[model samples]
Target: MGFTVRQIARRADGGEIIRTRAFDGAELSVGRGSDCDIQLADLGLMLRHARLRLAGDGRVAVEAMGGVPLEIAGAFVTRADLDPGDNPTIMLAAHRLTLARGEDGGVLVTAERVLAAGDGSDAASEAQVFTLKKTLPSKRRLAWGLVVLILGLGLALPLWVMAGRQTVLPPALVTAAARNAAPVATPASGWQPDRVWSSGPLSTAHAGLANSCGACHAKPFEATTDTACIACHTPAAIPAHAPAARLARGQVPATGLVADVHKAFNLPEGRCASCHKEHEGPDGALQVAENFCTDCHRGLAARLPDTRLANVPDWGGHPAFKPTLVVQPSLTAPRFERVALAGARETSGLVYPHQLHLSTRNSVANMVRAQGLPGKNGLLACNYCHVPDSDGERFQPISMEKNCAACHDLAFARDGGVVRTLPHGKPEQAAGIIRDFYLGQALSPRAGVAAADRRLPGSEARLRTLAFTSPAQARAQADAAIAGIFGKGGTCAECHAITDTGGANLLTRFAISPVTLADHYLPKGRFPHKRHLSYDGRTGDAACISCHSGVPRSNLASDVLLPPLSQCATCHGGPQLATAAPATCATCHGYHYGESGHGGDALRVRLVVARRGE
Candidate 1:
C-alpha cells in the first residue's frame, strides 16, 4: 500500500489543515497523479535532499543524497520513511525540490532510499518516525496575576507602616530632630576637677633664679635653649651709673656731661655705656662706640675751634681756651688765622675785607664815620642789604632776576597799555630769543638791517634786520658783543661789591665754588662776607654782628644769618640792580651770539629789548 501527503493549507492564519490519503487495495500507484502525490514528493525532496519528478504518466524518478538516483511510486500519505502502523509522523523538507501533478489522480512519486550496488533488495532496514505537537500551559496567566499582587503590596507597604506610628514625620525632619537632641545639656556633678595643664611647666632649675626667663632668653619658650649668658652680662650698661645718677639729680648740665667725658678720656661727645652691653641673651644689645661720634662731629668741631674748648673748665681765666690739637684729618691746609689784604691785588679775583666789616660794633656808626654820606643815616643793619640765615642764604652768586624779584615786582609792557608780570630770571624767554636769533641767521642773514642792529620788529626793526653787508663785518660785530658781556669787569659788580681795602668779593668767591646745583640760575656759592666788607667800607662798615646778632662767632661761617630781600631793597632800588642798557641785550647776557654758516652772509643776533614804546 502507498501513502500520500499534501498540504491543503498552511498554518499561517490559525490552525493546521493538512490532507492525507492511503491506498491499500490496488498495486499502490506511487506517482505524481494528484495534488497529494505531488505534495508527498515535494516533502520527501525537502527533508532528504532528494529530487523527485514525474518521469512520464505514472513512474517517478528521484535523485537521493550523495547523488544516488532512484524512482518511487506512492499514493500513501504517511511519513516518507515510516510505516503506516508507526506513530503518525510529520516530515519537513531539507532541500527545495520541484513537484508536478500527474495525469492520473491516483499516484504519488518521491525519491526512494537507494542501496549500494552490492547490497541486495532484501537487506534488513529499520525506519523510524515521530510526530510533533505543541501544547501551552495556563501558568503564564497565573504569573501575570502574581506580578500584579506583588506590585500592589509594594505600593501599600510604606503607608501601612506609617499608619502604625504615633507621630509620622518626614525622614528629613526626623533626622534633623535626632541630630538636635543628641547634644542636650547635662549639668556638671558637684565635685570640682583638678587644673588641666595645656603647656609644659618651666624647668625647676630656672624657677628660683632672680632673673626673669626673658632676661636670659631673647625669644619665647620654643626658641633653642642653648644660648650664651656672658654676652649680655660682660659689657657695661648704657649711661654709666655715675653720670646717669648725676643727670637724674640735675646737678650737671648735659653739655657738662659731654665735656667731662671728653676731658677725662678723650671720649668726644661721650656719655657712658655708649658702647657697652648690659642685657645678656641670644640677641645682642644695640650700642655703638665713642669712635663713631668722632667720624661726623670731628669735621664740624675742627671748623669751629670753640667746639674743642667746650670740654675745658674755667681754669682761672686760662687765656680763652684753645683747641689742643685737631682731632680729624684735613683736606686742605688749615687757616687758623685770618689773612690780611694789602697792596694792588689781582684784578681778575674777588676782593674782600673781613676785619673791617666784622670788627665794627655798630655797623651804622662805622658807615657814618667812614663814607661821611650824611644822608646815609648811620650804618645800616646787616639784614638791611645782606640777608641772613633766617631768610635763605642770599649772599650766594644768584641770578639777578631771581634774587632781586623776591623784593622787586617785575612788569613787562606789551603792545597795548598792558603790563604783564615777568618770571624771575626769565630763562625760558632768554633761551627762546637766542634760539630765534640763530634760526633767523641760518635762514636769511643778509635780509635785515645792519649786522650791529640785532633787535626784532617795529621801531627796533633796524636791530632785528641783518644787513651784514659782509660776512667779515658780521663776524667781527658778534665777537665784539660777546667779549663785552663776559669780560672781567663787565657787569660783575653791578649787584655785588668789593671793599675799598681790596678784600675778596663775595660773588667771585661763590662763582668759584658753588654750594648746591639744584637752582641752576642761582650761583652755587654764597657771598655774604664780601658783600658785608664792601658795603661797610674800609674804615667802618656793616658788622657781622648786625645780622648775626645772637649767633656767636664760634659758629661756622657757613652758618651766617640771612634776611629777606625786601629788607635790602629798602635801601637799594630793584630797578637800579636789574635793568639792561637801553640799546643792547649784550648788557645782560653776552655769551649767546654767533652767525650761521648756511646763510648767504653772517648774521648778528641779539636779545630783544622790551621798551615802553615798541
Candidate 2:
C-alpha cells in the first residue's frame, strides 16, 4: 500500500550518507528531478524516469516512464514483474536500486552509485563502454545485404533472365489462355515468372487486357491518363456536363469535412472518378450514394446564396414542379412556359372538352363504345384517345386521323359504295377542294341518288339537293357550302379556330388556324402511363382518373389538366415519408442533362413518321 526509499551517497573520504523517506501511496515515482519521490542528482536521469507499482498478486512491477529502458538482472527492459523479497537490482542511469520487503509488509527501495564520478572519464573504461564491435550486425551491413538481395533477385536476376530469352514473347502468347495451354506438371507455357511482381489481379472490366498492360501503362512508373479510358466512354454528341471544372466545383460546399479531406489529399474537384469509382471487386452494382447529390444540393442556398435553385435535401424535400405548357397560340412560334400545374392553363388553339367525351352518357362516349374501346356503361376510357407507345413508357402523339376522325368524320360527298372524306390539317385548301368537287359533279352527275342516301347524318346532304346545270351555278353553290362549313355549327369550324380573311367575303375566303397539340406537357418530369394506370384503384372503374382528378371535369383543351403536386405526394414522396411508395430526388430528378438519363415524366420520345424519325 506504501513505499519507503533510502538514498545513499559516498563522500571523497569513502564515508557513506543515507537518508530514508516514506511515501504513503499505491505507487512510487523515481527520477532525477525534485518532483519525483526518489530524486537523484545525476544529470543522466530524466524527470519522471520510472514508476514502481504493487500488482494484485503482491509482486512489484517496475516500468520505465521515458523511452530509455531500466537495467534489471543484467538485462535492459522497459517493464518487468518481480518479487520484492528477492531483491531484484535495477540500474537507472548511474544509480543502482534494490527492492526489498519492509517490516510493515511495504516496499523498501535502496539506491546507491555503482561507480565513482571521476572514474567515468578514464580513457581505458570509456573505450570499453563506447565500442559496439559485437553488440549486433551493423545497420549498414544489413541494409547493403538487403539491397544486394533485392537487386540480384527482384531486378537484376529478372533482367538477366530476360536478356537470355531467345525470342520476344508476343502479348498474344502471354495471355491466360496461352499460359494454361501446357500441362501444370512442368514449367511449360504456365511459367510466366514476371507475373510474380503484380500487386493484384486485373478487375473484371479490364481482365481481357491483363496480358496487354501496355494499352494503359504506356510508360512505366506513370499513372494511366483519362485519355486511355475516354476512348471507350465517349459521351453523346449533345452538350454534356460543364466544360469548365470550376463551375462544377462551385456547386460543392467550399467548407466541409469532406472538402477538407479532399483538399488535404490535393484532389482536384469534379473528376469522373469521384462517383464512377471502379475496380471495387467488379461485380457489385455501381450506384452512387445519395450523399453525392445532397452534398452540393442540400442547404445549397447557404453555400451559394445567388443560386436560383431551391435546396432539395432529398426526394421528399423537393419543391413543387412547374410543368411546361405551350403558352402561345401560334404554331410557328409557340412559346413554352413552366407554370405550377395547380392553377395554370395552356394556350393550344383547339377547343376539346375531355369531360364531354369521357362522360358515361355523352354522345362521344356512345360513339366510342360502339367502336368497342374497352368501355362499360357507354363511357370511354383514357386509353381510347391516349394510346401508349410500343414501350408503354409514354403515350404516342395523338393522331387526329386515328383517334378523332372515327367519330368526327369530314365526309362531303359520296360515290357508289364509297364516302369521300376531307383532307385533315389542310384547312386553307378546304375551299379549293369543295369547289372542285361540285364542279366535277356538275359536269358528270352520278346516275342515281342511292349513293348519297347512305351518307352519315352530318354529311352535306343539302348541297346535293341544289339543282345546278352549269359550272358558274355550281361554283356559287360551292361558295355557300364552304361558308356554311367554315362558319359556326359547321364541321370544319367546330374544333378548329376559323377566321374570315380581312376585306374578304366569309363565303369565299375563310381560313381555319391549324390546331397544335403537344406530345409532351412536362419536359422536366417523366410519367410512365403504364406504371400509373392503376395508382388509385379505389373505384372499380376509372382507376387512372383518380389522381388526374381534373381530367373528368376539364372541358377546355387549354386547361392543362395535370394533377396537382398534392395529389402526387399522396402516393409518391420523400424516402422518409410513411407510405407504400417512398422516393428520393433520383426517383424523379437527374443531376445531369442526358435526356435518356432523366426519370419521372420527362417525356421520352420515339419520333415516328410514317417511316418514323426524330
lDDT score, candidate 1, position 154: 48
TM-scores of the models, in the given order?
0.22, 0.58
RMSD of 2: 15.6
Q: After best superposition, candidate 1 residue 464: deviation in angstroms?
A: 11
Index of the highest-TM-score prediction: 2
| lDDT score at residue 120, model 2, on the 0-100 scale | 54
**Model 2 lDDT per residue over 1-614, tens place:** 58889989887799999999888887888887788888776667787899999886668999999978989999999999989989999987778899999888888999988866755532335565677866868889989999998877776655555445443323433342233332121112333333444466554444544444444444444445444444433444212443454346446744678778767664446555565444444431134556666777787677656555578777657677676666655546555566666677877678788788767766666676676666677676677777889877667777778777777777776665566667787655766777777787788776432212222322335435434699898888777777777776777665777777753553346666655566766555556676776765554246677877778788787787677778878888766669778765555544444542222232343212111010
Model 2 ranges with Cα > 4 A deviation = 1-229, 242-246, 254-267, 277-286, 302-306, 329-332, 449-466, 502-508, 536-541, 594-614
The alpha-carbon deviation from the true structure for residue 304 of candidate 2, after best TM-score superposition, in angstroms, is 4.7
- For model 1, the run of ten residues with the poorest summed lDDT: 516-525
TM-score (C-alpha) between model 1 and the true structure: 0.22
Badly placed stretches (over 4 Å) of model 1 are: 1-311, 315-381, 384-401, 404-467, 493-614
lDDT of 1 by residue, 1-614 (tens): 23243444334364557565544333232223243233333323332333333334444434343343332232323313322222222222321222333234533322222223123221121121222222433678768988887655543443343344343223332343234222121222332111011122232222222123333333322222212232222222111222333323322223666667655553323222333233332122223332332333334334444332222121111122111111111223211111111111111122223232333345434543454433234432334334334334333343435333322333321212333243433323422333344344545653322223222111122223344555556444444432322234422222222122222422122222111211111111122344444333332233544443333342232221333323333333222234221211111112111221110111222212111110
- In terms of TM-score, how similar is model 2 to the real structure? 0.58
Alpha-carbon shift of residue 268 in model 1 (angstroms): 16
